[model samples]
Target: MEVAEVQKQYIRELLIKGRKIEAIKYLRTNFDLTLRDAKRLAELIDEDIADDEYIKRPGPFSGGGVAILTIVFGLVGVIMLGVAIHLYTSNRSFVREAEQTVAIVVSNPSQPVFEYEINGQTYTYYSNVESDPPSYSMGEEVPIYVNPSNPNDVLINTFMDRWFLISLLGGMGVIFLGVSMLVFFAARAR
Candidate 1:
């Protein structure tokens, strides 16, 4: 909204009284100006009036949108972490009874694809199914654990294969929680 001449004069008076930050906050509340625009306008007012009243101040970080986003991100991270933990435990249990064999890395265009033989039957597998990084070179031999009941079910024998999802989701959770804490504390500081 366009500020009336009287309102503009009042804003200038506020700036002259060393209330430039308050003037900007007032502009943000009363006008349609963004925070950046309000700050810039407040600074311009000080420059034009030859006053040193304008002092940059940090704005509020707390908002409903930020709170909602923090909750959503934190919840998703927790859910992913939970799934990873569950799969890791299940894989561990299976590995205790599963058969171990060597699988040869056959090809990798986007993800690694490998094959192994069990009882004269060749089984093809994609590394993307495990979400493990494609660290294997072509023809490289890697150990894998295959479920005894279902030969098709397998797990790569590596620390990353076991804990990758857990680490990823935990890291994301920490980051989201950290952001939320920063916003929460910064708002409270004011």
Candidate 2:
């Protein structure tokens, strides 16, 4: 559950300044907290704090919670990066070992299709290649690398074809990593 607000600090400050009515008013106006809730909060604050010093207490979303969220984001980023790396390596390896041929491009609703020939046999593969306005035009010849054992497995040997997914995932991973590091450091500092 998400907290509506953090009024504890403000309430504590008001209590420290000996303005109980203002503290209660602030809680009611800002957080929509009931009188009982405001009084309860005031009492809790009074019990925990002394006259000279304010003891810092952990709330629902303490530093620990922030740390946990950081870990979760970091893990997701690592998983995405790992999958991207695996796909990139596998595609590169397939291109290096598979038979090279030229495929005729055909227009499709979702994406362009590739029609290629292998040992007098024609095979059609839906391209996963992403581009605005489509990269290959109808009747265009594109370089194709297909697995010898399983002809269905194909790869288009282009920078966008080979590196788009990897780049996207790697970029996301970097962003998550950066955010997690920043959150972790900030939480620690706090």
Model 2: per-residue Cα lDDT over 1-190, one tens digit each: 1223355776777787667789778767776789998777668776776867654456434647776889988888888888888987888788778999999887762378889999889999987655677776789888889999989998887777778778999889888877888877776674
Error of 2 at 106 (Å): 3.7
The C-alpha lDDT values of all candidates are: 0.77, 0.78
Go through the candidates in order and give the C-alpha RMSD of each one to the true structure: 11.9, 11.6
Q: Candidate 1 residues 123-188, lDDT tens each? A: 998876433465777899889999878988988886777667767866776676567667667666
Best model per lDDT: 2
Give the clashing pairs for model 2: none
The C-alpha TM-scores of every prediction are: 0.51, 0.62
TM-score, cand. 1 = 0.51
The per-prediction tally of clashing pairs is: 0, 0
* Model 1 clash tally, residue pairs: 0
